[model samples]
Target: MTISCNPKLIACHDCDLLQSLPDGEQRRGKACCARCGAVLHRYSRDSIDRSLALALTGLVLFLVSNLLPFLALNAQGRIQDSSLLSSSLILWQEGNTFLGMLVFATTFLFPLSSLLAILYLLLPLRLGQRPRFSIHVFRYLQSTEPWGMLEIFMLATLVAVVKLGDIATVIAGPAMYAFALLILVLAALSASLDPQLIWRRLDPRCNH
Candidate 1:
């Protein structure tokens, strides 16, 4: 889960003991619970810049993935192409509205919005300016992070390509590669983003 929150007393999920983190920020390290000794938080330098670069790249790849042909099929010498958006729309046209909406929300809507939201919050901060509703938007992002289910979408697409290959000539499209890279970018963005670090930058009075 990716988030940017101001937390003073973090409760250990395993033991439910609320505790404070240690003083001094390092380039890379994890704070652990004193009782159960579980990992509390991780701190790293240049997290904002790293996350910003990855998010910007992700937004570009996401647009490419949705615009270009996602995949193509050649059956009986008849060629057909489909984009990521088309796939979801096809599901809707085929009376699978629920699944279509789910795919659209999880794959297209959630991921795009997440990247945009990150940019919205981070860009101003990067320029040494505080964005409007910093805390509110940051907190809201945390709720929507889990809904970006691109990994699941990728897994399903892989299975589909394999199964379809047995019948049709599955031609991987440019968007397919873009989508693959987009997934990796988003994954790295999540890991590189440090919630605590952002909280400190956003609010100096944090944990004070």
Candidate 2:
């Protein structure tokens, strides 16, 4: 029942001296090493509120990323553009069903599920109620997070754009950059968030 991989309440990163943190811990505000002034945990001031806003923003961006065309390429006076979902469908139509399904699940499903899970976990915590689906949401987020392929998708798109530039005129779509930034932000959000914090806020009785 390890709630965190980081066990030391306060530790000097340079010297490796672990100090036991005093509770209240300034209401879980911040813990610093007394010996070296190294920060251990800097608690977020408005975790629930900020997480909720980010989750909602992520949802909207996820929708836009799937709905709008990613990019347009014009070759020999013929133009082609595709949304994220459309690209998957195109792959399937071209007899690459496995790759299509992989792309769809990685680029769309996993990331969206992660965002929704964060929302599900945080929303109820904000209202001072235990989240009913806390465990399910945590499991969903943890399982789906690794499958998010937005960064890989961006890299692939870049390679395609560079290679296609020799044969066609390439125009980037609004959704393309937005989607990339969205992925980056979501990744940051996921990394910054602590499940223990959310769980504690949700259910104080749960063993950490």
Candidate 3:
């Protein structure tokens, strides 16, 4: 763990109140706005190595989720399977252009972008080297985190499977499991990630 020797002052995003951190060693915690009780930010000392591992794993699962079959629908003894990209293409071909684009963006593109961005930002930091555009990439992650809807997509998939089971046999494909695991990995990545550690590595003077 990196040692922080001095206290720092930060402005609350909620109330715009400036507050000082306790004088001494820094530790894992959540800072809240004194006036509004809104959460200002969080601090933690989680390992960088673990985050890198999760990023790599999520990337692999993402690939498998896209390349392999996601689901197989068997109706009247006819089996039809679809991969992630193919599903989007099918939707586009069927003239659901807007929804196709939405699914592609939220489920595939945004999620992949997030994983790649994580690797890009964390890989160099893990090697004890400073990465270019570190601040921009980190800010991008913060801004775009809500855009990636892996969990929402997974829930929709489960609902579709359950509903389709009454009329047709829905075989859970390899990609389904991979995507599910990818969701879990990404969630773990988000939780295990230490904002304090990332900012500390990115900038020595950074306090939040």
TM-score of each: 0.87, 0.75, 0.85
* Candidate 1 Cα errors over 4 Å, as ranges: 1-9, 27-29, 34-38, 204-208
| TM-score ranking of the models | 1, 3, 2
List the candidate numbers ranked by lDDT, top first: 1, 3, 2
RMSD of each: 4.3, 5.3, 4.2
* Candidate 3 C-alpha lDDT tens digits along 1-208: 2333333666777778877655324655676778888866555454577888999999999999988999999999999998878767878889999988987888888888888988998898887787889889888887888989989888988899999999999998999899999989999888767765677678756533
Estimate the overall C-alpha local distance difference test score of candidate 1: 0.85
Clashing pairs in 3: none
lDDT of 3 at 191: 74
Best by TM-score: 1
lDDT of 2 by residue, 16-86 (tens): 88676555324655667777777655566466676788788888888887777789989889998877777
Q: What is the C-alpha lDDT of each candidate?
A: 0.85, 0.74, 0.81
The per-residue C-alpha lDDT of model 3 at residue 99 equals: 82
lDDT of 1 by residue, 9-82 (tens): 67887898867666635546778889988878877668889999999999999999998999999999999999
Candidate 1: clashing pairs of residues: none
